[model samples]
Target: MNSRRTALVVMAAMLGSAALADWARPTIKVSDSFKNFKLDAVFPKSFGDWRVDENLPVIVPPPDQQAQLDKIYNQTLARTYVNREGARVMLSVAYGGDQSDGLTVHVPDVCYVSQGFRMGETRDATLQVSGDIVIPVRHLMMTMGPRLEVVTYWVLMGDEATTSNTQRKWVSIRYGLKRQIPEGMLIRVSSINPEMDKAIPLHKDFINQLMLAMPENQRDRVIGRVSVKKDDSRS
Candidate 1:
């Protein structure tokens, strides 16, 4: 009788422990999962032949002057993406206007933040229309946290040259929460079909909430780059 009672007690204890483990959800340390990104470009060469026309007032801005513009434009891009309710984010801008004509800039797509486990993401969306561009793996690795290997894919679009610019990215990042994120929860941080201003709202709310939950100091650490729309309202 004593032996039977002891075995039953041991089995019950094992079952209880398993149940407790099941109830715990996987979680990521706020410090590790957070980061920001930034990128920008400036034009120094005169569009000598590409100039709009002699009659046109197109003239290359002095290097120093261009540098000043860089400072301002880069800051604007950062403010648009990173300074949100206190979240580390990335900002990127590419500009090259002919004095007489306009310049076409390609903006890399902003990847979506997934549930934090499993496959990061795999799809394409319309960001801007700038014809065709490449994402490249090396760049993708930089944005994704150091924990996972980088993956690449190609994205193509037509007509919407501006939207195409930011829609294509080359890297996919995977991360975890319970210290062991199940393969099922992971998602990609990129764009989807039907490029339109309205698309921004879908996941923006969730990301903002995540940022709000993080500590203030962590929020201040701006890390990555962002794509800026000349018309802030459209972005």
Candidate 2:
């Protein structure tokens, strides 16, 4: 599906579901499992070949748009980093303690289109977190006027990656049944590149490098694999 179709499908699913809005209230809190969960402190500013570039500018939402974001997100972080080769990537993250919005609406697919950017179809993809751990993700190709940007993103819910709205809703309902409220973190990586082939691998490497630098539990918050490993160990 194209961006418009994808956006409409999600919006329809959201607006049509009265049950979701009512039942989606978080009952129990599910911690991110990190001692002190601070996005700025948790994620490294300089990792591997990439380092924070003070001169680079990342996309900033208008004041009105930021107001809406503030309501949903407890904390938000935005930064631009440059690899040694001079390539730059933008990272945007939003964390909410009770992200039981039925299906998360704060995604690039939804918000980018709303912001006048022409997003292409959002495709399902995978990112190899380590030697064995792989996580599902969504890739977006967007443009506004003469600029082209490629994005890779995923949402974390209860140590699981929820890339689709249906997946997000299912995660919420499952946790709600247990009287648990799942925390949510939307991690997005974007770069200005016309060639997606080149952009995606760069994103994967950048994320893998960054995650490897973090502790296992802290890393799983972004990639979602804490319980999975524990379950594997039990076997």
Candidate 3:
């Protein structure tokens, strides 16, 4: 009996030691690397026909809402852009160093619902900024009383853009398994237009033109470079 009990204790100690070793593994901290880059500089102030609106009233969330957002995000940027045609687009970007499940950036769907807006149709979309570059985005329609708006947004987990909560969580887990923590950013653009057909295409054009004006490195962070794999069997 004494020998059996000793063996059991030894096995438990070995398992605990293995668990500790796993937890102590080194991780590539992407957030620290991003600290040197400025998001404000990443996006240009004026691009093509669109220019930043200086007179537009700044959007301020209610105190409670602002408090909640402050807890999740480390940095945020909000701006309004107006084109020569009098079209205006509201842009919001929020970044968080810790992209874990608890500290992840909230999507427009959740934010709208919290602010008493009814969510309409939502679908995944691909934005082709150029012939060779494609970025995944989420398209959503939100309405509250007479106010209706169309929104296009995406979330970046490290270098990958993900449109769904499940995808975001999966990416987080993949990094965690690799013993790394990934930073995340939410990029959202919205316009007050009831015509979904016209609004969507305009939004896409705005995104494409804006991307063209950004630096190559900055653009990649927003829309990742696609890797084409050659078929091994063909060779």
Candidate 4:
């Protein structure tokens, strides 16, 4: 029986090594790269009725945590915006040149959990930016003691936007099979509000206005290609 167990362990080890070898093999080639785009320039300073709040305190991970994040992401931007109505929103975007099987963008759920915030309800949502231009997103509420926040985020895998981690993995594998390594970005927008019902609509309005203000060419980085059919009447 011991000898049989030893043989089984050996087989398992061999299988693990084979899988590691496959993942390490350079079978993927990056046909198109997003490395050249500047993330800072992609987002505007003032958009619609909102303006940048230079005095607003932006929360970021400490040096040790940030060091770890730096290894995963090539670039990151964090900013706060406020409108004349006294509403405020925080935006964060992280981009990586290689979003292959082993390396990928980190989602807010993981980050918030790591930061000691209790993750609340999470669901997939679609944001109608304009006439028939809907973008997929993940919405969740997070709380730490009495402080509550509503977060809306999305991951851009190449030109496709998805909220499912499974879908992101499939996209990476599909591109890997085609010998193409895809780049990806994670965009997160959040606001402090205990009332999720009202907070969500405000978040959507902020996104819509922000997207409208962004340059046409750079908008895809924040919100991936709109796949919904166009409403000619609205256009």
lDDT of each: 0.28, 0.82, 0.80, 0.79
Residue 89 deviation, candidate 4, in Å?
0.4
Per residue, candidate 3 scores C-alpha lDDT tens digits across 166-213 of: 877887777877778877788998999997777887888788889889
Residue pairs with clashing backbones, model 4: none
TM-score attained by model 4: 0.82
Ranking by TM-score: 3, 2, 4, 1
Measured against the true structure, the TM-scores of the candidates, in listed sequence, are 0.20, 0.82, 0.87, 0.82
Q: Model 3 reaches what TM-score against the true structure?
A: 0.87
Q: Mark the regions of model 1 whose C-alpha exceeds 4 Å error after superposition.
A: 1-85, 98-122, 126-235
Where is model 4 poorest over a 10-residue stretch in terms of lDDT? 226-235
Off-target runs (Cα >4 Å) in candidate 3 are 2-7, 10-18, 21-27, 102-105, 226-235
Per lDDT, the best of the predicted structures is 2
Instruction: Rank by lDDT, highest first.
Output: 2, 3, 4, 1
Candidate 1 residue-wise lDDT at 145: 42
Q: Model 2: how far is 89 from its true place, Å? A: 0.7
Question: Which pairs of residues collide in candidate 3?
Answer: none
